[model samples]
Target: MPRIACLHTFDSNAAVFEEALRATGLAGVSLQHTVRADLLAAAEREGRLTSDIAEETVAVLRGLSAQADAVLLTCSTLGPAAEAAAPDSPVPVLRVDAALAAEAVKAGGRVVVLCAVETTVEPTRHLFEAAARATGAAVSVEVVPQAWAAFKAGDPERYRELVARAAGAAKAAGATRVALAQASMAGAAALLPETERPLTSPTVGLAAAVAASRG
Candidate 1:
């Protein structure tokens, strides 16, 4: 069996990422979950990247990489840390946002990349822009910081409510599609009306990583 490591921080649970992996139905692949509350708290407090946090996170990934065929980091705030961990890993390290970014680029002009946290917003924008540039797609990315605060506050209903509002704002801003920046936002996206705008989630990216790692 192939093993994949999923690294997460406090805003999301490992199960959400694992559920996406299970939905893929790929044989001989299992996921290992790693969580670091301190790292999450630090990122939330600083609202930006720090070398210390990055180093701690990379240490976690290094431990996981020893046992897994591939790794995926679910926290958008720690994306730089995840990337820094990648080059040194014995296995491939997949950024959870990568697939969603690619999907957003493919969705074409004026793509709205919605995120729940302030720290996540800019990093996600950078990811989307990179993806859009690579794909030759003209796009616009917006960060919805309030959504994450609501979700972290433990009100699922409120999270849904905020996501709808964010989606509406994105549409008004000329976004043809919406991409959820975190795996935890999948449920919130489902609550929104399905119309001309398409919704992209991180689940598909995790699934793809699981499959690629298995092969």
Candidate 2:
């Protein structure tokens, strides 16, 4: 079995990301999760996240690496730390947003990167811009800054409602797809109609990336 470690900035809720991975029914795959709200707090204070926290985060990854084949970062905020640690880490490391960002680019035209946390907007925008640039695709990012509070307050219903409203606005604004910037926003995608442009979530893409890295 190939073991995969998913790193997160939230204190818990890793299982939410793993569901789609397990749904694949690709037997003999082990999944592990590591949570560090400290990283998220640091990002909030620093105004941005980068290699600055690599020392501590890398140590965490190192510990997980001893027992896993690869590590996947599930938080957009600390994804850069994973990118920084990948070069020296004992195992392969990947930012979950990578695949989602690429998908955003492929979705074409304007991409709305929706997030509950206002601080996450810019970093997520940069991720999407980089992906769009890599594929020679021209795309613009739009932000929905109203839902984070609800998620933080433990009011998922209100959070989902805000996200759904954002999706409607995104459609009206000519967005080809709405990319849920935070992993937690993944649930918002489900609230939309199936025929909509489609809201892309990172869970499945991140899981697939980890599975592919096993080779």
Candidate 3:
């Protein structure tokens, strides 16, 4: 069994990814959660990530790494910090969004990345574009600020509603595919109308990352 450490945002709990892993029959793997309100709050304030926050996040991952075979940072805004933490880790470290971005580029070119948080959007866009470039695909990314607000306000129903609304706009914006940038937006994909468009979520990405790292 692989030991996996999941670093999450202050607003979320490990239950989100725990359910995803359970569904995958990967329950044998040890899963741990690390939550830091300060780091998450810092990201929310700056509308972008800072190296200091990245360093502080690394401290959390480092602690978890001591007991796990791999680490997965569940927050999209912390992707850069996650990447920075990897080289120092004893095991592999995966940014939750990177795997989804890779999958999105593989699934479609005109991809739309939707994030609930303002700080998460640009970082997610950068990761998606980098992944698309690697796949030789072109992408168009957009940030939906309102989506994050709904989720942060402790309303999952409103969050899903906003996600569907944003997905519709993404479709109109020439996005043949949509990638929900945060783990909180996972099931929101189901809200989209049936069409040629495909919706991607971080749940699958996190699962894949854990599997790969464990292997």
Candidate 4:
């Protein structure tokens, strides 16, 4: 069994991400609330990540990887830090969006990165571009930054609606596929069943990636 150590910034994402792993038929999941929200908050406020903050996230990863075969980082804000830490980790440390980015590039030319948070937008776009480069795909990114408010207000219905509207806008902008940047946005993706464009979720991507890593 591949014991996945899921590192999360918010407690809210734990249940949803664990359920995603279960849906993938991999039950060996350990969720950890890395109380490093301050680093993310600072990163969001500064519009860039500093080494000290990234190191804080890496420190959390180091402490959690002792008994696990893989680590899944569910927060996009910490993605760059996760990637930076992977080289020194004892096991594979994966950003949840890794699979989603690869899938988006494989499926479409114009990839729209739909993010609820401002800080996550650039990291996600960079990941998609990296994936696109690997696939030799010419891709352009369109970012939609309008769902974080509903999320912060603790309104699920409005949150989903905002995300759904962003999805519609991405399709209208000629996006071949859309990738939700946050785990919280997965609920929004669920509510968008009638969406004409292909949408990707980190929850689904992370589960699939961890399952494959076990093989």
- The number of clashing residue pairs in each candidate reads 1, 1, 1, 0
Give the alpha carbon lDDT tens digit for every residue of 40-126 in model 3: 789778767888888888888877888888888888888888788888888888888887888889854677777777787778878
Best by lDDT: 3
Worst 10 residues of 4 by lDDT: 27-36
Report lDDT (Cα) of residue 196, candidate 2.
64
Candidate 1 residue pairs that clash: 116-148
Worst 10 residues of 2 by lDDT: 197-206
Pairs with backbone N, CA or C atoms under 3 Å apart (clashes), candidate 3: 116-148
Best first by lDDT, ranked:
3, 1, 4, 2
- Per-residue alpha-carbon lDDT of candidate 4 for residues 1-215, written as tens digits (9 for 90 to 100): 56677777676777777677666665655554444567777887788667777888888887767777777777887888778878888887888888777777885467777777877877887887888986665555544555677677788788878887788777787777777777777776666556564455555666755674575
Best by TM-score: 3
TM-score of each: 0.88, 0.88, 0.89, 0.87
**Candidate 2 Cα lDDT to native:** 0.72
Candidate-wise lDDT, in order: 0.74, 0.72, 0.76, 0.72
Candidate 2: segments with Cα more than 4 A from true spot: none
lDDT of 1 by residue, 46-117 (tens): 987678888988899888888888888878778877778888888888778887788777856677777777
| Better-scoring candidate (lDDT), 3 or 4 | 3
